[model samples]
Target: MILTLLDRLNRRRAWLRWGLLAAGLLVAFGLPWTLYPPVATDIVCWGLFAVAFDLLLGHAGLLSFGHAAFWGTSAYGTGLIAIHSGVPFYVAVLGGTAAAAMLALPIGYLAVRRSGIYFAMITLAFAQMVYFVTNQWRDVTGGENGLQGIPRTLPGFDLSNSFVFYYAALPVVLLGLLAAWRIVHSPFGRVLAAARENPARVRALGYPADHYKLVIFVISAFLAGLAGGLYAVNHGFASLQEVYWTTSGKVAMMTILGGIGTLWGSLVGAAAIVRLEDWLATAGFEATGLVTGVIFIAVVLIFRRGIWGTITHLLRARAVAPVPQIEPHLEHDHDELQPTPTN
Candidate 1:
């Protein structure tokens, strides 16, 4: 009876986790219709971008400082396609994401060979190379000025309206989030996590650690590129600033602020930082960098695990009810077993 009861309790816990996740998704879907719709939509975009960063940094234990390469490349690619081809917005976005992934394959292959700070430096250097290319290739790239007048269309849907655009972007963002969640929960994710924890041990088990890392790097790049494409459409332009190293560093800070390994935490951190910066700027704060830096330091010092981690920890602690001790027992047929015991 006790075993049966324990089994049921475990099942209930699993169901509850799924239930909470569904509720969170529903909230995200409804957010754009609520107050501050534009801000909410922007939050969704940055959230998706941050999740991509977390995928490589947190899940794969790969620190990339040149992720802006993917982000900016996708934005520019999508913007150019939108401007020149008059293609459907979604198709353009996909093209952008594919371009970013293709770029990641060669770059990530070389960068993934080096771990720690060297890995980060390789990514940074590669990003700088990309930036320089965009700047020097003035005729094609528009140099420092960036690509302007990018089309913001939703195909059959009339996306000239803000609400229409918000709804359109919301579904894509949700799909991206779902994909990220699925990837992180699969067997691939387990192997990736194992690789991160101990690459030597994982290789000893015959798993190709480098291959897994490269795959994840490409995946992360693809998603970041998707977000960048969406960003271009949302703003109706693609800028060189999108590919800057500072932008990459800001993403790293956002991910760390929200909870390095927690996917949702990255989103939360991005939203918080963006909103806070917006508010501060409106309040005559010219030195936003100084304020943000101080806050980042404070967050790192106090909430090292980030808001989601802290919330989860608190909730779990609150749920720590006393567990009842169980003792084992056996029942036997007295007549048959008693004779054996006596013997």
Candidate 2:
């Protein structure tokens, strides 16, 4: 009886998840109509960033303090490529993602050797180096001023308009999200889960745990770079602030606030944070960081599992609760009602 009840609950939970996904799709497609086009675009870009960070922090069990290196580098690369090469916007974004992967190779090679805080420190250190390089390379990067007038174009269409560009660029973001989902559901993803839980056991099973870690790190950087490139194009500039440590920290906050291991949760977290910042800015609140930090602290202390995680936990708990046991005679009556087979 317990097994049967669990099975039914499991089915119900699956249906609920599917329903949520459908609703989420509807929201994604309709958001631009309700919100400012630029804000809607920013939400999607930040959502991608959060999802990328979660892949590394949540699934790979690695904490990085310097993902801004990937994001910032990609932003600069995208702007430079478009300014000089005059390639299509999507092509430039791809170029930027590719460059981020290359940058990740050496960083991941070194960072994966350490775990815990050491790993984070190494990434942070490398990110600082990248920031220095970016600041000094004024000829290309535009130093403190940043690169402005980066074009967003498709041969025939005028994508300079924010509204037109948001829809055009959205499909690429969706494809990136789909790629993440596929990776998480793949066999390699199982190995990542095992490594997250028990690295020693993964090595005992003959898997080169270091290789897997490096691969996922690069993959995460690629996704982040993709987001950064798109962001620069959408805004028509690449700013130095994109490479700042706070940007990396912000994405981490979004991932944690949304439920780190849940990809959709990352999007939810992004929307919440982005919208809050937007609202604060519009209201002329100067201490945006203070307000955001206070709310983040409150959420962490109250909903330790994060918004999505806590909600799902409550649902599962209710599902597993014993239904009032059927009356004892009800079972007996059901057996009596069953027709006996003739021998």
Candidate 3:
């Protein structure tokens, strides 16, 4: 009976996970009906971006403050290809992801040397350097004026329609999520997780810990770049703002708020942050900074496990706990019955 109950629970948990995934996809594809399609697209892009950062920060246990470099680089790369070279939208995005990964190689080499706060500072400095170059390089980056008039979608597709763009963005986000999930669950990912928990132990195991860190850094950058490219295509432009240190900080916050180690938590965090920002904008609240800061602190204090992480932990605990499956068998033998049988 205990085994039977356990099997039923395992099936239920599996079904629940699948159901949640289906619901998420459905909402991504259908949400444009109620909300402006662009908004949903933006949320998806940012969510993916945050998740990418979470890979390094949460899984790899490296906190970088310069992830905006990849984000802005991809946005600009794809936007330029779409606007100037007339490359296919998908191709442009691919180019952007590649560019970000290539850029991460050199940066990750040096940044991975340090750990904790110093590592973050190094990334921040590098990101600021990128921001400065973009702001100064008028010919390619258009200076502070930013890139404009990036063509959206393919020539045949009606990109202006929010629903169309939402659909277009959906697949990209899904692919990015899949890649991140694969990396986190793989054997190499296990090593990285070990490195995060104990770098010395990972190194003692004969793994070149720095190499693993670099690989994940590059992967994270690539995913982040993909999201940025999507953002550029969806928005029809890329800007200096993408490279700003604050952008990196924002992604960090999203990761933390969503539950750093939890993959989908980043998405939940991004949605909450974006929606809050939108509501504040609609309400003409000029003090959004104060409001957001307060919420960030509150969430950290109240939901340390993060919104998604906390809920997931609770569900997992419930799923794993044993359930009462059978009542005890009660036996009663009467002497009168025995005498009747003897007769």
Please name the candidate that would achieve the greatest TM-score relative to the true structure. Answer: 2
lDDT of each: 0.86, 0.91, 0.89
TM-score order of candidates, best first? 2, 3, 1
lDDT of 3 by residue, 149-253 (tens): 888757777778768878877898899999999999999999999898888988899999999999999999999999999999888889898999878988888
Off by over 4 Å in 1: 1-12, 320-343
Angstrom error at residue 139, model 2: 0.1
On a 0 to 100 scale, what is the lDDT of residue 170 in model 2? Answer: 92
Task: List ranges where model 2 is wrong by over 4 Å.
Answer: 1-6, 321-343
lDDT of 1: 0.86
Residue 225 of model 3, lDDT score:
99
The collision pairs in model 3 are: none
Q: Write one digit per residue (lDDT tens) for candidate 2, span 1-343.
A: 7778778888987899799879988988998999999999999999998999999998999999999999999999999899888999999999988998899999999999999999999999999899899989999899999988888967988997888899988998898899898899999999999999999989999999999999999999999999999999999999889898999899999999998798878998999999999999999999999998999999999999888888888887877776657667654565467787532
Each candidate's TM vs. the true structure? 0.89, 0.92, 0.90
